[model samples]
Target chain A: MQLKNIFQEGAIAAHFIAESIAKHATKTEIGGHNIFLGQVRADDIDGKKVTAIEYTSHVDMALEKMHEIREAIFAKYPLTCMHVHHSLGVIKAGEICLFVFTSSKHRKAAIDACAECVERIKAELPIWGKEIFEGDGYQWKVNN
Target chain B: MSIEIIFFGQLADKTGCSNVVVDNPGSIDALSMVMKMQYPNLATAKFVIAVNNKIVFDNEPIEENAKLAFMPPFSGG
Candidate 1:
């Protein structure tokens, strides 16, 4: 079976998030929803300002790892649904690079699951970002 | 005994190429030695080795046509 791919080519659109939330309306069992958006930050380094971030990943490994994470979160939380989308290629500062949404019968489960999912995605996914500076320089971004 | 080694993230930058096919060097330690010799710049880089998508630490014997991946610290969200 094919695993669900969470990658998008560029910046995630706001309407995509809206549509995702809208789609969950029919699922009456879910009483609470939590969302997390990761925006590309224009960080200044050594007098250079970051203008964008170009993301890349090992597709096969990332999907496999994501599947494992998805299963684990379901096993641990009473979540009704979970969705993750991360952007590849260049995403300008102030644009959304990641969107994580979780739904549950209670507020706490969705809230906690969303948080944990974000943390794990940052720490575990086999993805990298190249920070493009405003002028001509670039550097690999490291998560803190 | 051909083993494919794939490089990811900063390790790819250090290696200049993403993937290399090498003669199987018997064990993980031997493969590391061979890789360091072939790509001297990789000697100073920090990375973890994964065999067939699973991270491995022990000097396990590698079978023919195994896929190896060298990954640097993950920085994705």
Candidate 2:
């Protein structure tokens, strides 16, 4: 099966999350679902508060890497389904930038798979974010 | 051989453009040498090379018209 494109243009909305959960109601085999949402934090950098993050990516490479991560996760865990979404454009502070959802027959698999997916995506994908400060200056965000 | 080099993130900003076609320096390390000379900022920038969408290590030979990307450390969620 082909992998889905995880990039979205704007912040992921709460309604979208609810819709995603509703779509899986028919899958009776799934007993538990775990989610990980990455929200943009308003960080004070050098006394300048960050207002938003403008995200960019090497789309072709990111998709290829994400596909590999998905395959590896599926091979390691007994998951019913998995979905990953990330914002590509500007996302304001306190906005949701990433959404990872995993479902499984048991809670452990779902929770573990969701956490693993978030970690792998953060490490492996070719996505970058420029932290936009309140005064219009920007800096490249580095993951800690 | 001529190859297309795509830069992302801060590398693109430093280079002032996102993509360019450059004379293939034959090997990945050779390409790095040429790029460092062309874009001085790259000399100290930490990045990885991907040839045809797969990350490659040192000494990987570049094929004719291959797509190569210089990518900085990822900061995705």
Candidate 3:
């Protein structure tokens, strides 16, 4: 199976997300849709504050893993569509880093599938985030 | 024979470079020994090894021109 590329060069734009939803309007069968957006938080470390997050990933491996997760989620849920996008490079605080959208005929399937996809992406993808502080310092982010 | 090894996240910082080409060390265990010797900081670092993009828990034989990667725990959203 050809792997779907999910990584975007920078933060996900709000207009791009709006366009995605607008395109899905043609699929009238979808009764419900769930969307999840991940934003960079301005976390304080000691006296320094987080200014941005730099994301990196093993591209080939991450795409392969994402494909597996997509297949599994499709098999587990009755969904009409699913889409995911993750930011690469540096994303500033308050910017969108990740976006997950799922649509299904029923609200329950869309809601559950969207949640599962986000959780699996966080745990499985070979991606890392470096939190850049106000001062030239940085720290690796740990998923909680 | 040589293998291509890539490091990710903090492992890359510790290694001073993102990738290296090393002589095939025969087995994953032996490869680890060689890597730790070359990059002593890795001796205390925690990471998982992936041979050709597949994570292997047990020591596995290294093939010629294999692509290996050292990855820390994932923190993607």
Candidate 4:
């Protein structure tokens, strides 16, 4: 399954996506839920203050990559369910930008699956965001 | 000619726009056109183009209507 646009107003919280995912997985007898949320910070870059961010993506590619991540995680981890969400366009500092949630019969499997899914997204996804500094400069961050 | 071009990160900053179409037929290659008009400084920069989100380099054929996304090296967490 895929989520089209995940948000609650200006918020990018993972809980919304997790709730939706839970609703979609009624047959899943999960006992643990592991969630990771990525937030934007006012990072300082070479005297520039990053106040916000501008995001862009190859939408079709990003979706495809996300699907691949889900499939890969399922193959490696015995998870009951998984969900991934990302923010496009501009996300202000203190705003949630990305979320990955995994549920399983055991905590270890949930945690492991969550980690792997997020890692794959960072490595293969074609989404990009530019951190808007306080000054006239910006920086791009990926999961390094 | 129909060409799909995508932008990302700093290159998007330089381009002041996201993806765009060329529209008219041209002899210049897609990458060359992007390099020439979009981010000329990238002429020597390390980067890659994702044809339908798969990264490939050197003589990657540009189909009539394939979605192409361009990116520079990335650093994140």
C-alpha RMSD of each candidate structure in angstroms? 1.0, 1.0, 0.8, 3.8
Candidate 4 lDDT by residue in tens digits, A1-144: 563442222447556765666684575577888888888888776777788877666667667666777778899999887766777777888888778778889899999888877777777776666777775766676556
Ranking by DockQ: 2, 3, 1, 4
- Residue A39 local lDDT, model 1: 98
Worst 10-residue lDDT window for candidate 1 chain A reads: A54-63
* Candidate 2 local lDDT, A80-135, one digit each (tens): 99999999999999999999999999999999999999999999999999999997
Q: Model 3, B1-77: lDDT tens per residue? A: 88899999999999999999988989999999999999999999989999887888999898887889999999997
- TM-score, candidate number 1: 0.97
TM-score winner, 3 or 4: 3
* Model 4 TM-score relative to the real fold: 0.78
Number of residue pairs clashing in candidate 2, backbone atoms closer than 3 angstroms, sequence gap of 3 or more or interchain: 0
DockQ of 3: 0.93
DockQ of each: 0.86, 0.93, 0.93, 0.43
Stretches of candidate 2 off by over 4 Å are none
* Order of the predicted models by TM-score, top scorer first: 3, 2, 1, 4
Expressed as tens digits, the lDDT of each residue in B1-77 for candidate 4 is 77767777766666667667766333235566655565676576556777767877566567777767668665322
Ranking by lDDT: 3, 2, 1, 4
lDDT score for residue B25 of model 1: 92
lDDT of each: 0.93, 0.93, 0.95, 0.69
Write out fnat for all predictions, comma-separated. Answer: 0.84, 0.96, 0.90, 0.32
User: Best TM-score goes to which candidate?
Assistant: 3
